[model samples]
Structures are given as structure tokens and as C-alpha cells.
Target: MMRVKHGSFNHVEVVEEMIFAINVGYKVNDLCTRCSTSQLSQSRRFPFLRPVRFLTDSRDVLWIMDTSEPQIDGPDPSPAVDHGLLAELESLRQSHQSLRSRSAEMEETLLLAQRQREDCVNEIANMSKIIESLCSERDRLASRVGELEELLKEKEDKFLSKFEEELIERESMRVEIEVYKKKFESVEEEMEERGGLLSRSMEAVQTVKDGLIKVIQNVDDDKIPETLGDENGGNGDLRLDSEFMPVFEQIMEVRKLVDLADSKVSEYKEMKGKEKRQLENSVVSLTEENRDISSLLRVALMEKEAVEKSLNKLKGNTEQKRVALLQFAERGLQRVGFGFMMGSGGSIEQPMVESYGASSTGSKSDGSECEEEVVSLASTVEKIMKNLRLEITQLRRCLDESRSDNERLESLTTKQAQQISENSLYIKELEERERLLAQNIEELLVDIKETETEVDRWREACELEVVAGKNEVEERDKVVTILQQELEKTKSALEISNGKLKLKADLAAAAMAAQATAEKSLQLADSRATGLRERIEELTRQLEEADSRERSGRRSIMRICWPWRAFIKVNAGNGAAPRFPNVRRMLPEMQSLLHSRV
Candidate 1:
């Protein structure tokens, strides 16, 4: 028998109650098993749920009821006990069904949440990849921009230095050109003075030749009379020889002076020809230098145009990249915002619906906070985009200014080339004039040689006549004296002309020295120009490589962004809020990624 406490019910009553509770527990267990079985069948029905079937199915409730026979040591069971047991069992079955239905609904919601969580995780991973790629692209672009800026700075510095050198060289060349012009003008003046002297000398030689011819004619006419009277005039011949000896000596001195003048004129002509050839060579060298300078200028212009084209390409690439980044940012923001809202709403509504009015206020507050954060993020993105646009505009203005400067440089170069061409043409004209003068001088030299030969023959004939014409000696003495005086004047004029020729030769030597120095300077300029051209070529190659790299980068970025753009478009078209699972778990990571970059 069982001893019961005073406050407690009798053992019989206790036993009945205990049995009822056990029966109800068994019924609940059965309902739970049924629910679990139904869930498992439903999970099996969907291929997608096969992996999660175990997770979605509710656990089987095992009611460890006392299966052994009850020890009936108290009283016999009553009819009331049976009725009460029946009624309680019915109520328990109804409650068990309700709980089973509720558990099934909860399981379904859990499955949905799990599916969303998986999708959100996948999307978040994709988002992370995209963010990483974008960050890498940003870093690459920033590095490229920095490199390009450095290159531009170096190129600008080099160009400025080259321009300054060119300016200095041009100034030197101009000064040298002016010097040459002054020298040429001086040469022209000297040439004119020499021409005047040559004309005077020719006139004096003509007068001397005429006087000699008249004296020779008088000797010829008196030759027969002198031969017949030679013996009778022997004493007169002796007296005439004494008086004519000085005249004969004077004639020989005049012949020597004429020969000296002829030799001096030949030397002067040779020196003049050499000077003319040197001048022509100098002119040729100068023309060549000018051509080289013009070619260098053209190369510089071509390099400038190439640089401008590269700059334009860089600008276009930068603009495209900016636009792509903006579009990506906007799409990412939209996706993140929509996902956050959907995730928060789903998470909140689940608790609200399940809790049956519990924590409703807290869920509403959480949703508002999420919306506010999203709006702030959007506004910040907008502000960033605005700043970027402003920067782009400023860059464009700078590019425009650079373009204008390039155009101005091109115009200046063109004008300089035109001036150089004109100078070359002027030099050619001067050469033509010099050639004509050289021809005239050669003709004068030939005529002088012929006059010298005729003078020599006349001197021989006059010597023979002097030997035979002793009787006419007194009459010829006056003519001889006059001819001697004229010969002395011719010798004096020849001496003056010889001194001028020597001075002209010295001037030519000085001019040759100046030309050599000019040639050396021009050679140095040519070397420098070659160095600059090589540097320009290297810079152009670098720019081309940079452009190719930029193009490849753009292609890669396009390949990466296109899929995401398409995805965003599809979601938008569907008008369905993008769902993000595990928002509370992923929010921190997404925020860090976005905030750090933005």
C-alpha cells in the first residue's frame, strides 16, 4: 500500500491523474511524429530541399510513457474517471493537432529563411569579389594616373628645356646671320672699290699701249733712214746713247713693273676665286644646316601632335573608367539598399507574425534605422559623384589650355620654317650674282695677258730700231722721256693696287676663320637636335605602351561589370525586392567594404 501525504490527493486519485497525463503525453508524441513524417515527405517531394531535409524536419517527440502495468494497490477505477479521461484525451488531441500545424508553419518559414540565407551568402560573396576587383582596378588606375602625370611632368620639363635651348640657338643664329650680312655688305663695298680700281688700271694700261704703239710706228718709219746714215752718224749715235741710256733703263723698269702687276693681278684673281669658293661652300653648309633645323622642327611638331593624341586618348579612357565606376557604384548601392530593406523586412515580419504582437515596436524601429542608413549612403554616393564630375570638368579645361598652347607652338614653328626658306632663297640669289662676277673677272684676266704679250713684242722692235737709228736719236730722246714719265706713273698705280689686293686677301682669311667657327656651332646644334629626336621617340613609345595597357584594363573592367549590370537590370524588371539572407551577419562586412571606399 502507498502512504499519501495529508495535503496531497489519495493514491487512487493520484494514479488516475498520472495515467491521464501519460496518455496525453503519448498523444502529443504521436502528433509530433506525424508532423515530422509529413515534413520529411514534403522535403523529399522537392529535389531542392533534399540537402536541407534533415534541418527542415521537426524532431520526433518521444514520450517515455510507463509501459509496465500500473500497480493497482489502491481502489477500483470509477466510471467518473473513465469519462474525465475520455474528455481530457479529446482536448489533448485537439491541442496536439494545433501545435503540429503551428510547428509545420514554423518549419516552412525556417526553410524559406534558410534558402534566403544561402542566396544572400552567395550574393555577398559575389559582391565581395566585385568590390575587390573594383578596388584593384581603382588602385591600378590611380597608379597609372600617377605614372602618366609623372611622365607628363618629365616631358613638359624636357620640352621646356629644349624650347629654351632652341630659343638660345635661334638667337645665336640670328646674331650670326646679322654678322654674315654685315660681312657680306662689307665684301660688296670692297668689291665695288676693287672694280673701280680695276677700271682705272685698265684705262691707264690702254693709254700706255697707245703711247707705245705711236712710238713704235715712228721708229718703223725712220728705220730705213737710220740704216743708210749709220756710219756718217757714228759720233751722233755715241752722243745719243749717253742721253737715251736712262730712257732705255726706264723702259726695262716699266716692263718689270708691268710683269709684277700682271703677277699680282693673277694672285688676286686666284685669291678671289678661293674666297668665292669658300663663300659658296659656306652658303651650302648654311643651307644644309637650315634644312636640318627645319626637319628637327617638323619632328618636334610631330611629337607634339602625338603627345596631344595620347593625352586625348588618356582623357577618354579616364572618362570611360569614371563612368563605369559610377554605374557600378550606383548598381551596387541599389542592390545593397534593396537587399537590406527586403532582408530587414523579412526578418522583422517573421518575428512579428510568429510572436503574435510581441516586439512589434522594436521591429519597426529597426526597419526605420535601416532605411535611414540606406538613404544616407545614397546621398553620400551622390556627393562623391558630384565631386568627381567637378574634377573631370577641371581636367577638361586644363586639357583645352594645353591644346591651345600646342597650337600656338605649332604656328610659331611654321613661321620660323617660312623664314628659313626665305633666307635660303636669298642665299641662292647671292650665289648667282657671285658666279656672274667671277666670269667677268676671268675675261678681264685674259685681256690683260694679251696686252702684256703685245707690249713685250713692241719692246723688242723698239730695241732693234734704237740700234740702227743713231741719226734720229735726238728727236727720239724727247719721246723716250715722256714715255718714261708715264711708265713711272703706271708703276706707282700698280704698287697701290698690289697693296689693296694684299688687304683683301687678309680679309678673306678672316672670313674663312669665322665660317669655320660657324660650322662648328652648327654641328653642335645638329647633335643636340638628334638627341632630342631620340628622346621624343622614346617618350612616344612609352605613351603608346601606356595606351595599350589602358585599353586592356578597360576591356577587363567591361568584362567584369557587364554581368553585374545585366543582373541588376533583370532584378529591376521583375519589380521584386532583392532578398539578402543573414543581413545581420553580413551587414558589417558590406558596410566596411562600402564605407572604406566611398
Candidate 2:
């Protein structure tokens, strides 16, 4: 019975994957609460125990044997057994009964052990959780302390830097004060020189006043051109001296004013000296304040260094504790694995008689006692097995729930990781965009600087152009003045030329009148020459006719001297050498001669 329960526990432990043992052995009434009949299966070595039930009695043994026969098919052994085999079978029954009794006792003992082990495991689990919580708190506190220490260090560094800067500023101010003191001394020297010059000018004014008064008194009345001086010379001289004497008295008053201006200069110099001393005192006070601030900064830096060292020590300790906890968990898992393997071997079955005990008494009263004992033992074993099985099933259900929860948690983790990745990518993209924006801002600033530079350049160029334009305007004005002068000169020359042309036109009109008179006289001369030439030509013609008549009369005489000559002379050379023959022949000889001559 104990072995049966132990076997059930081994099966449960294998199935549940727990470090603790599982036992399903329990009574029928208790079984209903622990494991359902559906959760159990036959062991590999107990193949005859079908339907999740072990063959505990003779009746179950007989039932298993009969039911498994059809599966054996054709092979059969002899029904009668030999004496030796029978004796062996009887010995086996006795050994089986003894094993059953022992198993019952062992089962009770194991149940008590399991309860105590469960309590111990529970305590360990709780302690582990508390330790984890404590470790987390320690880490959180250490981190906070580190942050505080870092903050203190940063503050200290800043304080020291500020004090250094203040000291540098104080030194710079001291240098500036020294420079100002030198400038003040130079100004004081200049003031002293000016005061001395004023005093000398005042003395010179007094001398000039004295000289003017003497000149006014020594003026000569004789050099003065006075119209009424002749009436009373003494009276005129006395009046002039009276007016000049008052002018000498006014010069004496100016010498007194010079003394007052000298006194005021000395007062101003004293006031400047007092102000210089006050400025020197202020510079000294600022130097003292700078020294005090430097001392405070040094103290803060020392505290920061001490805290940093302590934080480093705490961090090293936490690391060692973490390594130790990891090693302990590893060893625990290895022990659990070894226990599971041993339990698996114990899960295989023995014989049925050994699994379920029988009654030893034959009397009715003894038989009842024996049956009750066996039945009670079997019932207890079954109850314990049922309980173990139930526990295993419940543990398996818990493991399944835990697995489902783990899967859900893994899924949630994957989703969260994905979301985180996306957020990281988004952040990266945003950072890139921010970088681009910063670049754009830088570019914009550069552009603005360039634009400002260009504007400045353009402004300078415009100023130059304006200056050039002004110069050009001045040049144009100069040229316009020169051109106006030339235009006036040209207008004067044009007027003179017009007067000359008018005079020339008047002279030409007079010459044209003279030429007309000469043309009339030349025409009269030409007419007289024509008449004289015609008279000479007429007289020459008359003389030539008279000579011709004389020659003709002589020729008539000569013709009478010859025979044919008288006929030729009568005809007078054939009237005119035969122009028309009939005219010459019909006319008388003298008539024809006279007609031809005419």
C-alpha cells in the first residue's frame, strides 16, 4: 500500500515539475475532494491495472486476467500446475502479504514527512521574497545616496569655480583701480598746472592794470584836438583828467578780482584729493570679501570627496551579495533534478498480491477481523493515492495557470518591448529632427550675420555713393558756372558780329547805287560808237562806186581800139557774166550795164 502511494507520488512529481513530492493515495471518500478518476493512468509495469485502478484483491486479479485473455489471442499454457510451481506460488503469496503490511506502515510515515517538508519549503520561499525586497530597498537607498553625493560634488565644484572667478574679477578690478589712480594723478597734475597758470595770469593782470592807470594819468592835453581849449586851457585839461582818472580806478578793481579766482582754485584741488582716497578704500573692502568666499568653497569640496568614497564601498558589497544568491539558486535546482530521477524509478509496479493484502483467518469471527485489517489497509492506501493524485492534479493545474500567466507576461513583455523600441526610434527621429532644427537655427543665425554684414557693406557702399554724388554735384555746379560764363561771352561776341554784318549790308547797298550810275554812262558810250562806225562804212562805199565808174568809161574807150572789144564793151562783160541769158540779151547795152550796176 505504501509503495502504491509512493509510486503515485513519483508520477505526480514527474508530471507537475515541482521540487516537492506529490502523493495521490487516499480513500474513496477523500479521493472525491483531491483528484478526479480521470487524472490517473496505469503504470508501465502494472499494465493489468486498467481504468486508473490497481488490482488490489483476488477478485480484481481474476477480473484483470479474464479481461486481458482476448488480447493474448492463440497461445495457451496447461491449466494444471506442477508441485514445485505451486509451492513457489504459495511462497510468493506469503511474501506479497508481508510487503503489503510493510507498505501500509510506510505510507503513513511518508504522509507525515511530506507535510513537514511542505512547511519548510513554504518558509524558505517566504524568506527568499523578503530578502529580495530588502536587497531592492538597499539598492534604491544606495542610488539615492550616490545621486546626493554627485549633487554635492557638482555644487562644490561650481562654488569653487565661482569663487575663483570672483577672485579673478577682484584682481582685474584692482588693476583697473590702479589705472584709474594713475589717471587721477595725471588729472591732479593738470589741475595744479592750470592753477599756477591762473595765479600768474592774475599777477600779469595786476601789472597791466597798474600800467593802464599810469598811461591814463600821463596823457598829453596838447595832443587832444579840443574846440573849446582856447577859452580856458586849464579848465579843458582838468575835465579830460577827471574822465581818465575814473578808468584807472576801474583797473585797480580788476586786480582785486584776480585774488578771489586764485583762492577758488585751491579749494577745488582739495576736494579732488578727498574723493581719490575714498575710491582706494572701496577697492580694499572688495578684496577682503573675495578672500572670505574662497574659504567657504574649499570646505564644501572636501565633504563631497568623502561621500564619493563611501558610495563606492557600498556598491562593491552589493555586487558580492548578488553573486552569492545566484549560486545558491543554481545548486537548489540541481538537487531537485536528482530527486526527480530517483522517484521515477520507484514508480514501476510489483505483483498484485504484494500491492493488495489478503485475510489469514478461516473462522467467521477471525475472518471479519482479518478482512477488516486488509480492507482498512487497502482503503488507506487508495485514499492516500487519491490524495496524492488530487494534489498532483491541483499542482499541475497551478503549473498550467502559471505557464499561461508566464506566456501572457511574455506577450506583454514583447508588446512593451516593441512599444519601447518604437518609442526609442521615435526619440531617435526626434533627436535627428532636433539636430536638424539646431542646424537650421545655426544656419539662420549665420544667414542673419551674413545679412547684417551685407547690410553694413551696402550701407557703407551707399554712403560712398552719396559722397561721390555730392562731389559730382559740386563738380557739375562748377561746370555750370563755367558754361554760364562762356555763354555770356558768346552772347557778347554774337552781338558784336551782328553789328559788323549790319554795317557791311549798308555799305553794299551804297555800292549797288554807284554801279547803276556807271552802267547808264557805259550804255550811252556804246550807242555813240555804233553811229560813228556806220558813217565810215557809208563813205567808203561811195568812194568805191566812183572809182568803178571811172574804170568803166576807160574800158569803153579801150574797146573801140579793138574789133571785138567794141562789142564786149557795148555788152559790158555780158551784162554780169550770164546770170540769165535772156535778160542780158533783150536789154540795151547801157541800160543793162546800169541795171546790173544798180
Tell me the deviation in Å of residue 34 in model 2: 41
Question: Which residue ranges in model 1 land beyond 4 Å of their true spot?
Answer: 1-240, 336-475, 478-598
TM-scores for the candidates:
0.28, 0.23
How many residue pairs clash (N, CA or C atoms closer than 3 angstroms) in each of the candidate models, in the order given?
0, 19
lDDT for each residue of candidate 2 in 1-598, tens digit (9 for 90 to 100) = 1222334343323222212111222122122211122222211222222221223442221111123523343333223423433565466556555545544544554465456446534643553454355345445534544554464456446545745675676578557656655655665554555443333133334343443333222221123222222322333333435333333334344434433433443354345345445434533543443344334334333433443343344344335434643453354334334354455534422222322343122223332433454354445445545675576576556545544544454454344445434544543454454455445545644654564455345434433333233333334444666787899999999999999999999899899989988998999999999989999999999999999999998988775443343454656867756433344444467555645564
Instruction: Give one digit per residue, the lDDT tens place, for model 1 in 1-598.
Output: 1232323532222223223333353333333233234442333222211110101012221223333443355334345634655676678767656545644554565466456546544644553454355345445534544554464456446545745675676578557656655655665554555443332133223333444444454433333122222222334433435555554444445545544554554565566467557645644654564465445445544544554464455446446645754564465344333454455657545533543343344334543543443344345345444664675587567556545644554454355445434544543554454455445435544644654455456455443332223213323555777887899999999999999999999999999999999999999999999999999999999999999999999989986543344544555677666533233554566646534543
lDDT of each: 0.48, 0.44
**Best by TM-score, which number?**
1
